[model samples]
Target chain A: MNNIKELLKEQIKFTDGYLDKYLAEKDNPQNIIYKAMRYSVFAGGKRLRPILMMNTCKMCGGDVNEVIPFACALEMIHTYSLIHDDLPAMDNDDLRRGMPTSHIKFGEATAILAGDALLNKAFEVVSQYNGNNPQRAIKAMNMLAVSSGTEGMIGGQIVDMESEGKDITLDELKYLHLNKTGAIIRSACTVGALMGGASDGEIKAVDEFAQNLGVAFQIQDDILDVTGDEKELGKPIGSDAEENKNTYVKLVGLEKSKELAKEYSEKAKKSLEMFGEKAEFLINLTDYLIDRKF
Target chain B: MNNIKELLKEQIKFTDGYLDKYLAEKDNPQNIIYKAMRYSVFAGGKRLRPILMMNTCKMCGGDVNEVIPFACALEMIHTYSLIHDDLPAMDNDDLRRGMPTSHIKFGEATAILAGDALLNKAFEVVSQYNGNNPQRAIKAMNMLAVSSGTEGMIGGQIVDMESEGKDITLDELKYLHLNKTGAIIRSACTVGALMGGASDGEIKAVDEFAQNLGVAFQIQDDILDVTGDEKELGKPIGSDAEENKNTYVKLVGLEKSKELAKEYSEKAKKSLEMFGEKAEFLINLTDYLIDRKF
Candidate 1:
């Protein structure tokens, strides 16, 4: 556990360094957008997605350098989504990662533009990949777009928004989480594997592992929201409940939700059996993510 | 002139067919998002960007089929920008092309998501391009992403938003319009030419042409906002003045703005002399776009 924690810390540091370089501020007049973009991006994110992608690439026998741009691009996409979700018209979140949201810090219009710019920048970064394998890059880019788009993240967001204050069925909830949170997570692993030249069988294994792990990760988030230290979580507890959000903890009992998260985590780990001892980092990651308090 | 108008009409028809096919709705849980996206996309747009791209591709001796996906993608990017620009937090316009704005019709959240989905879909469409020239497709895709990103459209938007109600300098106003409206227009021509297998010199010519035409189109829009008919424009005139927005007419007098538009249009048409008589449609387009009342 301690070794996993140390590895995670190093991954965060490495990811942040690459992200900073990719998103370095310009001296142009429209630099406010850059600032707002960087603000949300560097706001103490756990860097879980990028870390997952990089490790997955390494585990699949790919060079980390080749996947750096893609991992950073995914982080940018994630940050952009958070910025947009924090808008007053959406989740109305004023604080994210214990700092003022983009809209709060840079006015509504600039914040919106910043979010748009970040999303555009993500595609721009990936499109600039002039690597040896153009076809593979194109495939990864397509997957990222689809995962972050209407059929994936946005679709999940819409359903979640519509289902607010309503008693949604468990299937509906799963669908929401699967699209909203799960799709991008799955994309991170799959894109990494694809870019790493993983065989079809290996890609399938990572896809299944990512899908189950994504759901488990979200369930843990729900659990933490209900039973978490405010200081540790960096936001007030019960806010989801206050907003009448349909979370796993609310739909299923807390204990049942915990059991389900564990079940999913176990299933996630099972998917990595083909990799055996080579997937030690990923196995430990599954355990660490599921057992995380914050 | 009549011949040019006929060509323009045919282009619009052709572009719309492809757009409709590209954005065909699905029977899914997130169908509302699709509906909202299609609503704004089909809302009587002139399809100028796609028309320019396809024409440029044809004139450059590249098969129009090779550029069809890119042309449609540019149109989607244009539509998404309009959707976002019409949000309550941005321009706050109620009507676009005689129809209710996305936010006015679909609510703020869905409007934002629809805009995002469209942007993501544009990339997805382009990334799926599997022509014989994968490298060329990647180059076109990169150009599209960069042109629509912060250094282009969003950069222009930030400046425009910040200069609202302020006495911005003429250069500042020009920079704002050049970015906000010109980047994607230039991209339309350049990407089309590139995809059409145009040489470096030919690409340069189209780039210059599109840049000047974009600014001319924007200047004409400003002029029309002050002097054109509300019913013809499909929205209120003088809204820029009402909002104290900086425009070409506001920064320069009305006559000078018109002259500037003409001057830019002439420059735009001049750049196409390299293509000689084959560029008749584009030359006429420059004139028609600048002289448009709406």
Candidate 2:
């Protein structure tokens, strides 16, 4: 597609409208936590996870509404992570999406509580998804929990933090990145596959598709750190490089890293070949995710 | 009645043992988030909330084992709240329960993720309720969510923070406290009633019992600040006073606050009057709550 910017902009519009609708805002609100939660959730992003889930589910012939709650839950979980990560004790980010971070806009206590509220609310939102496929819904929830919980993103975050300034093996870095970023991305596709009622074989294919796409996406992020602009990226470019992070780029030279990303992207595309030419969105997404600069 | 401390000690021991088993420790595990989660969860505490749930359930003829998961879920939720509260952007507390807080022990990133994991794990734990009461289980889950989420504790925390240095009306103060402290306490009893398979009327009674108890317990905390020792309280006794918090003792004099607490404690006991002698543990717990030094 020649209009990637326009498509990305439209997707962000959907994210804004849908998230605002789901998280109703009120004036003269009694609680500060609710206000802070609304602030972080609406703080704005491209809604990448939700878009991937919706596009993937649509490719598998599922209605978007059926997957909307889980889509929103993914965003909520992501937002909660950002809000918490921006706290002074963590990454200490002052600006997010070119505005004050949650801890900057709201006080630190309110920001922390807001993150907590969003986190608890994500499960509540997912649990409300009671369609004819109750078992699948439960399975999707279980997958979401495992990917988002201690064994996944949280685990990876700890490894990343602990490994900072200290030398770590390439294997350790890969494991950390896979769990931190890879697990949820893969889960998003698997969730969409299950939501669309994919056959067992198709479900397995979708899992591989997403897993490869996630690795490729992360490697692309490593590439971006070396070759990105602050304006395009919407945050400081090469921040990771400055931090001496054990990124894919750091472990392998630039040439090898690019080759690895290309290999993973091709693998991701091949996984969807089982669905034949019908999986247009999945195919384009795999290309778009790795090729995009920001 | 003097043996109540012995009972509390015994209950604390059992809760610590059970909770410790679930948060199994490892030596510098592969997953940083998992290790951080275990670190914060197994950090010793009084285990007051879960004990309240189990003891209340037991008083209502429910086997403690059947309710243990939900009981642990309460503690998980509590632990999450504490971790978030200890974040540098939150309460910024370095110590809790006479030990380093979660954010202090683990870095802020891991601490945040640990709290996030614990909160999700709490909901997953609800799936373990073996009481064969799906409706009750769903209801309990909803109650736990609403009380701990944006509508309850988070809401209360917001107003409490915003009300800092500003004069809040008595009505505002009451509403804040009700949502902040009362909601979860009320839900704890309701969860206990659900596990015990109480009749509708019995559940109603337990909720009322908890509401009264919550108000009384909060008032007692307000009083303890003015008249408590550091060793007995295990914290700076007058921190609330130092913070100039709008506590019951601040709004009304100490004598009147004590009277209000005593009045509520009496009403709390009367709410359980319907269960007659079968609710002895609850009655004693209510007495202990309102009269305890810490």
lDDT of each: 0.90, 0.79
Model 2 CA deviation exceeding 4 Å by range = A2-15, A27-32, A58-62, A129-135, A199-201, B2-10, B26-44, B56-63, B107-109, B127-136
| Cα lDDT of model 1 by residue, A1-294, tens digit | 999999999999999998898788889888888888888898999988899999889989998888988899889988888888989999998898789999999999888888888889999888888889888998999999999998899899888888878899999999999999999999999998998889999999999999999999999999999999999999999888888889999999899999999999999999999998879999999999998888
DockQ result, candidate 2 = 0.46
Over B139-177, each residue of candidate 1 has an lDDT whose tens digit, in order, gives 899899999988999998888888777898988888887
Off by over 4 Å in 1: none
How many Å off is the CA of B233 in candidate 1?
A: 1.3
List the pairs of residues colliding in candidate 1.
none
Model 2 CAPRI rating: acceptable
* lDDT against true structure, model 2: 0.79
